[model samples]
Target: MAIKEGLRPGGRSARVQDAIHSAVRALLQEQERSTVTVPQIAARAGVTPSTIYRRWGDLAALLADVALARMRPDSEPAETGSLRSDIRAWAEQYLDEMSSEPGRNMMRDVQASATPGYCVAIIGAQLQTILDRHPHEAAPSVDRLINLVVAPVVFRILFSAAALEVDELHRLIDIALRLD
Candidate 1:
């Protein structure tokens, strides 16, 4: 999503969002997810229910916002020299993180959110960064990586009972890199 020019972290708006997101996270830890209410989150955040309604629309959106925050890359992808190695390493790491129980829960929350495209954008940005590292190689575009790799990994994480394997990720990476 296009962040408003002035709404970055440390601003009042960002502070409020952080507080609300923190509140939801804390509440989920303390009680059942289904039992957490808007008023409860608002009370915990020191904001009114209207404030959350105006900003996030509903509980699902708020949870999704938190999930998105959790999904953001904390560091750059591994610098493994070649495009194929870099992508395989990154995909394997991505699968490992997203296949865990908490990660699966977060993915499900993001799926239920109205701004699901943000998830794609987050993944795309990471791939773009990797692609940028190999300027001379005929690597796949970020869009192709998203379509041929990340999307399927995310799908298996959220839906399939079996965890996505690193070898499978390697195969997907090969397919993505081989594409024109």
Candidate 2:
């Protein structure tokens, strides 16, 4: 049977991908980063190592794609009328994600890929796409505002530490989104 995205019908691809994701997610949670191995993932997924290699090309690519897919920004930012509201919405979406299992896995993978240009490229592309859709002009101030809005969440994720409370997150959103 044919599979679409993450959906599976009856056949191989869906089963394989699901197993792969499960294995990867579990490995990420249970093992140290340096200890994760292709054989371990394959065993956890109940597939052969060759199966993973065939499906995802390599571990880094597989991790990157999964991480980016999970981290894909939500629609919350779009309908929010005010800039502050929009930014808050964006930050909140991420906050919600950060509290989840998949979110934690994605965050860890992303941080690990810090030295990889492809990882930075992926983030830059996503950020640019989001900013491109905004009606307001892209000025230095606007750029700074976006950075300010983004910084708190990223800082928390990267540092493995919390930077802002709910109130502070809201305040940061308020300050960053102000058009003046």
Cα RMSD (angstroms) for every candidate in the order listed: 2.3, 5.9
Give TM per candidate: 0.87, 0.59
Q: Tens digit of lDDT per residue, candidate 1, span 5-53?
A: 5666688888888888899999989998889999999999999999998
TM accuracy, model 2 = 0.59
- List where candidate 2 sits over 4 angstroms from the true fold: 1-19, 26-36, 44-46, 51-61, 73-81, 99-102, 114-142
List runs of model 1 lying over 4 Å from the truth.
1-9
Q: How good is model 1 by TM-score?
A: 0.87
Error of 2 at 140 (Å): 8.7
* Model 2 agreement with the true structure over 53-134: per-residue lDDT tens digits: 7766667756755676555555324445544455556567766667465666676666654435543454455445455556
Q: Against the unseen true structure, what C-alpha lDDT does each candidate score?
A: 0.84, 0.62
What's model 2's lDDT at 37? 85
